[model samples]
Target chain A: TQLLEQSPQFLSIQEGENLTVYCNSSSVFSSLQWYRQEPGEGPVLLVTVVTGGEVKKLKRLTFQFGDARKDSSLHITAAQPGDTGLYLCAGVATGNQFYFGTGTSLTVIP
Target chain B: DARVTQTPRHKVTEMGQEVTMRCQPILGHNTVFWYRQTMMQGLELLAYFRNRAPLDDSGMPKDRFSAEMPDATLATLKIQPSEPRDSAVYFCASGLVRGVGTDTQYFGPGTRLTVL
Candidate 1:
């Protein structure tokens, strides 16, 4: 079984702060995806990184895939109240199976 | 925007009861998945189907848990003799690809089940 371990299970920070969440695993993945889920709703896809050492940016969010494809990170800059949500990282292996991360709940207060 | 739809947003039932959750995938999606979420376990994939065929169900308990896709648009997850530990949010997601590679999944609101 493959497992993705996420760091900083809970995070609280004031507005304008910068934060980075990490997800690591021992197994290799064909693709990695980042999602943000608000309360009372299912997760929404933020980005998908398929290549090693890949970097993608969406406004204030920057996502990176590890050089070895065993890790990924999501960095948020100038966090605001709108950035608060549960962030999840999922890895897709050779099979159709997806392994989800431990999840990181972020709260940005104004 | 097309999205996955799940029925029975919330359900409360006693132990040993039979519980069923249904999902309607997006119009063109061919893959459907069921996941259980809890504080301790995070999100676990119970089962997934592709083109109305079972792909993998290793994460599901064979005795009490059953997942099936009756058609390309409908998928169901059933639990017989449900236990207290089954109280969690069950999510149904669908995607456009068969599996693997870069298929993006769209998730439904999820059905929250409480077994007492």
Candidate 2:
């Protein structure tokens, strides 16, 4: 099993709809990161959450770290076609071990 | 913008051939990482180096895969006698690991390898 698991593996939503993506793991992390990747490109860093139960906002997107630091969530307000891409979450475990989740591919239809 | 750059955005080679992928990390970045992305495995870490020294390569198939950093500016991943199963999009990323959780890893465009 992967150290990190993200679900709905695939998401398709209409414009203006709100959606959420979840990343879960059995192991606690020192921190978690979110990245967005488009086709023919690399993943770009979106946000990094360090403290447990931390909540960060990036414009229309809201990111939250679970109270146990073993999970995270990403929520988008008023999704748009421009938001179509693959969203991946990464975990930083003890001893600086870093790993990425399988990722959630979201398609925002206009 | 100082970003990671990888050479030969795409590569195609026959089985048993040697394939070399190169990466030029962002200046002053102390950590270099190699990853392979496939439909099934997602993004798997092949190896990583800190301060030009290999820290971990457990995720790589040591039989045919090799990773090296000749200098701070350059990193390389080599696959000798690559098989069709080795085909995937390989990415190179560089970051400054300050032991702080907020450090960011900047990724390259990635090399699409197709072993025939």
Candidate 3:
């Protein structure tokens, strides 16, 4: 089974603070996706990183794919209370198999 | 925006009863997946279907749980003789697969099930 470990399982920060969540794996992936889930709702896709050593920015969020495609990261700049949610990273391997991360719960206090 | 819809947003039932959850995927999608989420296990894929044909169901408990996509737009998951341990949120996701590349899966709101 492929494992996607996420760091800082729980995070609480004041509004406007910057934070970064990391997703790491020993096995290489074809693509990695980041999602944000609010209470009582399913996860919503945030972004997908396909190429190695690639970086994509969406507003205040930046996502990076590792050179080996075995890791990824999500950095949030000037986070607001609306950013509070459970962040999950899912890696897709060969045969379109998906492995989800342990998840990071972020709470941005206003 | 296209969205997946699920029925019985919440369900509370007694142990040993049968429970069924339904999902309606967005139009034009060709793949559907069933997943279960619990506090301990997070999210796990229970089954997957492509073009209404089941592709994988390795993550499901063969004896008590069953999943099926009868058509392109509808999917269902059933649990018979449910147990308290079966209580959790069940989600259905749909996407269009292009070759072997990664596909973006859109998930439903999920059905929160509780077995007493």
Candidate 4:
């Protein structure tokens, strides 16, 4: 079973569009991380949210942790072609287990 | 840049052959994790180590898969008699564990394995 499920598994948008991806889970987590991966490379960490209701902004991207620590969200404003990649959300559950969410693959058309 | 490094970026072998993947975690990091990625399963955690000791490996198939940390810097995952279904991209990540857990993980360029 997937602990974390992301909505809209695949997304395609034109440049300058805005988008939001959601990561939901039934279990609570101590911390959550967001990563962006390009082709032929590993996922690169974007941001980490530790506290409930925490929000972090990285460049044109924004990451938010749920109030209950069971979900997270990633938002991009004025998307660019460089934002096209696989976005993954990972949570640190109890016992230090790292659970990755069903990734959201985004494609931006120039 | 001190990042995780993995060797044999691509490997192709026949079924029933043994496959070994190696990883070198970033220096001074005490935690190591192994993951496999595929279209069907996404990214699945296989095993993890802390301070050169295995902390958890329940996600790994014990029959044909084994993971070991020979030293603090080197971690290896081996598959004996690998099957066709074992073809996937294997990733290794390392992090520094604080009191709670590691939230930031630095991943390496995965090793793509194909078993025909």
Q: Highest lDDT, which number?
A: 2
The true-versus-predicted C-alpha distance at residue B80 of model 2, in Å, is: 0.5
DockQ of each: 0.89, 0.82, 0.76, 0.76
Each prediction's TM-score versus the true structure: 0.97, 0.98, 0.97, 0.97
Error of 3 at B28 (Å): 1.1
What are the per-residue Cα lDDT tens digits for candidate 4 across B50-97?
888898998999999999999998999999999999999999999888
Which candidate number would show the highest TM-score if scored against the true structure?
2
lDDT of 4 at B63: 99
Local distance difference test, each candidate = 0.93, 0.95, 0.93, 0.93
lDDT of 3 by residue, B7-75 (tens): 989999999999999999999998898988887778888998888988899999999999988777789
Shift in Å, residue B54, candidate 2? 0.6
Candidate fnat values, all: 0.85, 0.76, 0.55, 0.70
Candidate 2 lDDT score at position A42 = 91
Model 1, span B1-116: residue lDDT tens:
78899999999999999999999999988889999999999999999888888899999999999998878889999999899999999999998885446898899999999999
**Which parts of model 2 are misplaced by more than 4 Å?**
none
**Clashing pairs in model 3, backbone N/Cα/C closer than 3 A:** none
Return whichever of 2 and 4 wins on TM-score. 2
Error of 4 at B49 (Å): 0.2
Interface RMSD per candidate: 0.7, 1.0, 0.8, 1.2
